[model samples]
Target chain A: MSALLYLVTHKLKNRVREIFHRPSELVLLLIGAALVVFVVFTGNLDVDPGAVRPRAELSAIIFALYALVFVLTAKNGFVNGASMFSMADVNLLFTGPNKEKTLLSYGLFSQMGRSLMLGLFILYQYSWVHRAYGVTLTDLVILLVGYGMTAFLGQMLAMLLYSFTSGSDSRVRLAKGVFYGVIGAFVLYFAFLVLRAPEGELLPKVLAAAASPVLHFFPVAGFVRLGTVGAMELHASHIAIGLGCFAGCLILYYILISVLDMDFYEDVLKATEVSFSAITARKEGKAQEQAPRNVKVGKTGLGKGFGASVIAQKHRVENRRGKVLLLDLTSVVMAVVTVAFAFFTKQPVGALVMSMYLMIMTIGTGRWAKELLLPYVYLIPEPPFRKLLYMLREQLPALLMQSAVTFIPLYFLLHCDPLTVAAFILARTSAGWLFIGVDLLLHRWFGAGSNKALLLMFYFLFCSLSCVPGAAFAVVLFQILFIPLSVSVLAMAALNLLLALLLLFLSRNVLSASESNNQ
Target chain B: MLQVNHVTKKYGKLTANRDVSFQIGDGEIAVLLGPNGAGKSTIIKCIAGLLRFEGEILLDGFVNKTLDAKKRLGYVPEMPAIYDMLTVGEHLEFMLRAYKMEDDGTADRLLERFELLDKKNKLGKELSKGMQQKLSLCCALVHRPSVIIFDEPMVGLDPHAIKQLKEVFLELRQSGASVLISTHMIDSVEAYWDKAYIMKDGAFVAERSASDTTEASLEDLFFALTEGGADA
Candidate 1:
């Protein structure tokens, strides 16, 4: 058997065995099965164009797919790469005496598998799709099919683009020029249509224009938009164009292989090296930053050599060499974009929601959390509690800075009460501490070397369980005791902090020498 | 002095090291010689306090994994654990802070001796394998611990670094610091080992002093014992 086929078969067999054998996973599967049955039989999935505007929904879909495409393009760019193969594939399949096109097929197959996994996620959002977009079951199914197809098509395009452009700088620039030209032409075309339409009907006209076949679908940015919109609306002309474009994507995806003469082994090795490093870091609950390298040498100094001062100084040096500071350019851009979103949506909580997204994202970036993965942190000859405090000092301040950037804007824009601003900031910071505390507790109990999937499951469970107590307590306290909102939020923050401290204390010896490598 | 008493390490059902006991006194060099999967690294990790085992380890008089023992112990792990974000110089600084000791020029001396002074500003990730191994040695040597452990210390080093490390082992032994080294390389084991233990199947199968039976060379004796009735 081929390496790719063998791994895929082996993994599928394992997954099936796990589903069939394990009681917990089996129960979850059964519940999901029951939910699907319930939805098919008695679920209220009816839709009415009478209430919601289908055009606006179409507009949302177009913008949403565009955003996804934009991110996909950015990730597949030379500077920021993407991975579609496992390390095993990189090692075994790439090194095998196979053609580049064969490897490409393997990569494409893996991408389709990923899309299938994500399709399950889309199925879970069916009710929201029904309620928000007035999409019926049939519309929802078509939409999901469009989504999976588009994702597969996007990967195909990315591979072709990467294969064509990545070998040199001039080629990359040329590729970018062509790409931006297409987007620019579409933009101007879009502006022309919208401007020519009557004042109240611009969006409807733009939506109609987006579905038209003048936009070629193989280039994907415009064609994918056309195909997806066509699928959602069940337009015969649109579906025909969509299927034709999809077929074109498949053919071009293969043709590009022979045309570009892609060095699949080299490309995969590079991709897999990066992917494996990230996977390793994430598995160890570490930050995902490019490994620091090629920095200008400076004088070695650990001034004062105080108890925790060295850690703080290390951060400063790291910031100087790499992006040690949390509030770097990316944070600035994220803040601007998030604030713009809130302003455009005219939703005060949108700011908070965006901030929460930023919070979750920033947690995964460079942080003290990642420091634990390296053995030095554990091997450090210091009091575990003191070391813990030192790490917290570095981590908590960054969390605070992020929260300040997030909620401080809301304080002014929403004209929130002083108490509301204070509660929001404290509650968010408390949530950060709660995450660290639970992470430490889990690391101590489960061991840092635990399987990545199991660790993630525990992390999700903790995120769920941790949110319940504070929110539940606040809600029940408000309904029964009639506490003021500020007091309730403050009390919840205090409760979270108390729990965090208790957890930290309980897991204080997490980095102690006695702790073994069970990973 | 470093002591590992009846150490037994298991990974679920597989025993990596079992009933392994050994000791090295002050100013003594001990070598644990084994082939791949011969339980050398497992025993070394158990001694370095990186793995849990069903036994006891002591550095000087303190429990090996205790903070007190950690302060006195320096370990050069089999695989150099490079901190990507830290430069060569900063790694030494980090050791100083962690051990709560002033540099007193020890770091500079080690860096200078290892010929890494020119590359002190290079981050851990920028260094080649040889450089990484040299930096690992520098990190382990900076604090001037009373006990030091090296696991396959010569594996990735260039000839220059291998020579420096061999010199370091002798110097460490001369300074009244006990040194425990684990390696399959006969040459690395030949010059430094005062006491040699051949390990296989998770336990020490044979032990001999440097003064014991010079007629049979270490390599010849190793192969004979390892491939003999014990199937070591």
Candidate 2:
């Protein structure tokens, strides 16, 4: 126990020391903290102080959003396959003389870092959520606390469920029942909202339904509401109830773990190995590292390639995942949800948000596509540029595939201009290429040892920069030529294409430079 | 067939491999015997053309980093670089395609020899560490390079795989291929090495050939240079 404590402290101290040593990372942290602090203190990230409590209609709707978020967390916890035990802990603490209690302690304590990260993200989302949901400063703070707690509970639930349900028939069925019951509540609520609302006045009834006490019965939804219900209504029992529920959950999870009798070594090891590989890949600038999927292995082979089987090999691996699922079911589900959101909210930005999401998924800001990590690449007899082109050839088509699946739905739902629709698709596709260009540029300039935060900052900066020249040219052309906006979109596309070619030309030596550095 | 001359590798202020020079002629098996952090892997990497070095390394008279040199050189890295998604058979196919070579049944032969033919359907992630090592060796040997480097090849292997590896090394030497093996286990390679270079603090302290007059085994000589005697 002492040794584990010492390890924890030593790691923390080393991290702080490392941060101080790297001024780039230190500055990045400071700036981010400053921004959060600035936003919170100025009271801008709250609903207008002069504003009154929203009507029953609006409160209900806002509560629906909260419930939506809660259910998503619980569902995510249920589905994600990884155990909370990291590779380092598995290597160190699992083999150590600690009891399961100590191991659980370590796992929960480790979750604090993730909670802190989520809290920061919540802080980032504070302003929009404040307006959209009409939450006060106190309400926002409570919600942040609730969100952090929810995230922690989600992790604990994932661990517990993973252990408890492993190879158990009844438990698996019960788990299925609980998940469906949670989701079914929302579906039933939506249906009721539709039936109960006055003719042609849907939003108000939906909002009213959200504030109903009916939501306080669902497990995560109920628990999270308790955390914030106090701030919304000045009731003291809400806080007590929320605290009691969370505490109860913790105790129940511990008891469940005690009773489960699971030998989770293999699960922990698989996760640890994947995470370790991910970290190594990150260090080597192989950015597209993802959550390891349980790929059903059957008939896997590099069927063929045009002297570029390196690319073919990757495609083969993806193909084993099945064509529809190659982009991942989560991504496809998110796309569907986005379309549903657009249909309901009647907002075009939903599509844009989905596009941005897909861009991040495809581009993987940090991952430069595993070209440098594996040695066989450097050992390959092909020309560096040809190898690079083949790699891009694989990704560009993948980006197109992802775009087609995500965007094809938006055309029907968004009743906008047809050329505008085309522009969005082309522009989103171009964004993925542009992001890759920026990524390659960052690697060419900084190498793999570059601070991740600072590198990410510069990466987004470069992506924005790539678009600037084209956007500027489009604007100038629009003013001079009096062209239609669709033509401007075409102009933008031309410049983006030019930028893509230029970036490829400039960073063509990425392979050779990375090879030299890797040595 | 492989020559490394004055190879110096530096990572920032730390010189991992300093002025490391050695040669292995065709039909010769050279062993790099060193303790952990003795820079054996660094030099092996330098020779493998994976790292930039201050000095020259030539593979069969070709500059080490050239496509031609890379084509003729095979390296099994210390840690097996297995693609988690690829099956054993796909890994070999990928290697063959990368080298622009046709399948000559070499992959199958090597897999059969290593007893890995049965596990060809398994994904790299599903394979145990020993299997991954054997698979790595199979991929490295499939290309049939003129020069080969193995880093800790025997670490995570079944006894059978280890025995097969030893047989492969002998066969490689017999076929006139220069082989460099970096390992900390002194006795494992003692029976097979024609020459051994004992390393300490990133430099070779002693070089001995089987025909040398020194009566001490490689272990005794290694300890003498690394720990027993304090060099002035």
Candidate 3:
């Protein structure tokens, strides 16, 4: 146990030392800290009382978010199991002189630490949450605790479920049946409540259904949400019931593990290996989202291409195997979820912003980024500029398709002019391409094997800076010159395209070999 | 022919390869013998044009980073870089198309020779390490490069695959293609290497040829040069 403690402390100390040693990373951290401070201070701004949304709506949304996360996490555990241990831990700590129970406690402790780190991102939304729901600082703290509890308890439930169901077909089937049955019951109950309300009052009815007392005692997610909202509302009974539920779950897990004396190393080994490979893939700029279990190896060859065009052909074949041709999982999820969000919230602009945010986060991990790591990109007999264009050939159509699916529906929902909607689509597609261009320039400047977290910070900073010129131009056109919104947006889209082209031209040498063997 | 002239590769202050110059002629097989971190792989990468080095490398009179040189040179890295999504056949096809070579039936023949014809449909990720190495070898060979560089090629291969690879090297030599192999396994290339360069501290300490070193075994020569008993 003491050795484990030393390992954790040493790792943390080294990480801190590394950050301080790197001036760029240290500056980025300071900038991040300043942004957090600004956001928190801005939360004190006064807003119209009548414009503030009801607390029930916010609680309902948080409840649904928790429920969705916990459910998906448990399902992942049922299929692939959850792992808090990395490959290094499995290799070093598991084979070392350590007790199994002590290791398990360490894993749980590490998971809690990760949950706490992830909760800090919620602080960025403090200003908006305050304006919407008039939440106090203490209430925000309670919300953070609720988020921590949900994430921590979700993993605990996954571990418990995995330990119980692994290596038993019947047990897995039984678990699946119970899981689906519970989800089905909740859906039917929610639908019943929503249908019983008047047709025009759908959002209110859905919120009412979520705020029902029956759901307050439901499980890890519901309990955490209940305790959070109860603390904010000063409801004594709700807090008691919610906290009691969590206590019960903790006691049950403790008793089971103690009584059973379970050996879970083998069960966790596979999950840990998968997680390690996924992390490695991310570091290498590969897309690991769609790890298909059963790929339909349809037609075998890279269809038809000469030198650099073979890269695009190869990507098409890979996308077919991954079943992500024109619209990938990210695009589909973004389109469906954002459209539904717009339907409920009646905020098409919000949906557009959300979709763009999701696109920026995911577009960096495309297959073209992985191509830079492979030798074929450099080894192919072609000009560097030609290779760069061919490498990104598949991305343009994919971006166009993604924009079409997401923004076409948003057109009618926003009730805006057709030309403006078209300009929005064009702007969105160009922005996605701009992100790819930024990624290429980063690889060219910093090499592919640089620290991903630091590179990601640079990525975001560069992307935000890249948008400034076009945004400023659009503001000048629309505000000062009194030009139409559609024309201003189209001008922004044109500038974004020009910038992307310039970036691509400058980063042509990214295909050239480097000292860092990214493979 | 592959020529590496005064090639020096450094990572910051640590020089991995120091003024390394070597050449492998047509119809010849040259082997680099070194201990770990002796700059064997660094020079191999330099010849393959996969690193920035203070050097001049030419593949048949073309600069190493030029398209003409890339079209003529093939490299098998220490780690087999097999695409997880592409099938075995697609891997060869990819190499063929990327090199702008016509379909010459060489891919199928090589797969058959390596006993991988039946698993041609298997994805690269599904193969074992040995199989992946074989597929990587097949990809590197499908284009029939004039100058081929292999870095630790026999590490993960099974005995049969290793035997097949040794035969392939002889065939390549017969075809008048320049071949350079880097390995720490002394006995692996003992039978076929026309010339051997023993490297230590990023510099070649000794060079031996098959005809010149008939009295002493190659292993003895390697040990003598690397284990601090002999001078350059």
Candidate 4:
């Protein structure tokens, strides 16, 4: 076990060294560290008298951030290109003569660094701002232990979920739906509590109730309680409660890690078989129904069309339908959920606008669009612009489908007015087209797959931060410049349309360049 | 010794292997010959305990249906299966950690033997196809299991790699480990193999022994058996 620990540490050190060695990464790390330090020290020095419950508020924020990290890390491929637990090293260790417990410990510890860094940052910031609740040595120890335990628990839970849903498309879809539903409910509940709360008493009793059990037994909860009590100068019982919570959380983590199925790793590996079977079965059923009639006439027509130039373009368009549907569905579902949650919380306008914006962004720049639009030119003989226009025409149904799915739910659920609905749809459609154009431009230059996803995520993040600039622009056009609503809308629409056309043209040229380079 | 007894594997409605049985004793090198989709690789994977089969595979009379039995067997998949981000040295280190092999000079010796010593620090993705194949072979052999199963192991190997692999198999045979290699490069390794099985559709149709007929080549036997009108 000691030797195994040593190996894990060595591997981790090597990984960290590799990360730090990269100039770009080093710069980013330095910038992030500087920002975090600036935020902590500056914020700590200027303490507000009214923020008496700063510790508790910070604790709640930390807990929420932890949950967000869990969801995002689990949803996105973190350690490996597949999942956190899907790293080949785990499988290799399992097959080796090493003790399973030792391997599990190493695996869990190896992946906990990023989570720990984030946790420590939050802990330090909270501790600094609330000097009365400054972390004692014992509190820091308890915080570290609690963070590690919770991370392990979260990892195990994610692995268990992957084991059951990884290979089963239907199951994965169902699981994702349930996960989204739970998150939605939590958000709604929190919003309700906030809206109902009196001024200076925004903390819900439910949050306290939720924290009590953990505060009484889990280390993470215990640390929060310690900080909160320390800040309040509460009795010694606060420390006792925090210690008890920490101990309980450790015990639970041990039980989960030790008692879980040993074959879980194997099960995760075999899960993809289920999805493959489901897809194959669906394909077979479709084939049986469509085979005879379509086979006889379609092949002849296709061959004749190929011989001539007339039908060549349509065939290319038809080939992209599946990909379009896939992208559209992902966008629509995310949009509907985001919007529906906003509507239920009585923020109907915000929900409508955000949903429309998200829908446009998701469809325009996502992996689905890149996969559909970028790859099929090799089989077709046409002007690159013509081919792209044909491809966009093929994607029209999917675009319409996405719009309807997003718009109908908002309109019906919120009883939105026609003008608001029109404004929302038109704005979203233009935004969507503009985004798709941007995505096409990026993809034409950078290539596709997960790289494209990463780029899109970064683009969205930047756009979100630049909302101030966007809002200022909107304000200038609408209020200061006194542009009429109709005129503004038409101008914005025309600008978006022109941008889309120009981008499409540029994308075609880029593709042509790439093809020539390949040749 | 490895014993495959009436083992069958199915993927939904498609049967990859059907009632296939074969045996290779210690010090014996057996080649599985087949065309594409001939269930050769399926049988190899089943023997290696990577895939569940209907019948039984026994390694030295111990049925390899459990993890314990599997630990004694080494499997090289058809593809070059190694983490792209990991260097050749790191890949070996991981294998050592996973298999609980001591950090001795065994892996290093294999690297030198395969002429991969210089490229040990290169990532798997940076390696040429042939180099990747060699790396994979080294990973499978690093733990030194009693039985080694190769599924199209020579797919991307250069002539030099092929020669080195042949030598490696001979060394493994001398070490008393049973070897089962499934490959289309039958003609190249034909002279070294002790026994060969020819598969067609989903079953082994013919078996040949070098001891029985030294003149008969695996390619001729494989073609004769998998040909359209050939009888099982």
Best by TM-score: 3
Query: On DockQ, who's better, 1 or 4?
Result: 1
lDDT of each: 0.70, 0.71, 0.82, 0.57
Candidate 2 CAPRI assessment class:
acceptable
Tell me how many clashing residue pairs each candidate has. Answer: 3, 8, 0, 8
* Cα displacement (Å) at residue A193, model 4: 10
Task: Using TM-score as the measure, name the better of candidate 1 and candidate 4.
Answer: 1
The candidates, ranked best first by DockQ, are 3, 2, 1, 4
Docking class of 1: acceptable
Chain A TM-score per model, please list them: 0.75, 0.79, 0.88, 0.57
Best by lDDT: 3
- Which residue pairs in candidate 2 have backbone atoms (N, alpha carbon, C) closer than 3 angstroms, thus clashing? A60-A207, A60-A211, A61-A207, A287-A367, A287-A368, A288-A367, A519-B50, A519-B51
Worst 10 residues of 2 chain A by lDDT: A284-293
The top-ranked prediction according to DockQ is: 3
Residue B15 lDDT in model 1? 87
**Which of the two, 2 or 4, has more DockQ?**
2
With candidate 4 superimposed using the best TM-score fit, by how many Å does residue A130's alpha carbon deviate from the native?
A: 16
lDDT, candidate 1, B34-142, per-residue tens:
7679988777767777677788999998997788888888888776666666788888988898778877999989999989999887778788878888898888889
lDDT string for model 3 (B77-122, tens) is: 7878788889999999999998888878999999998889999998
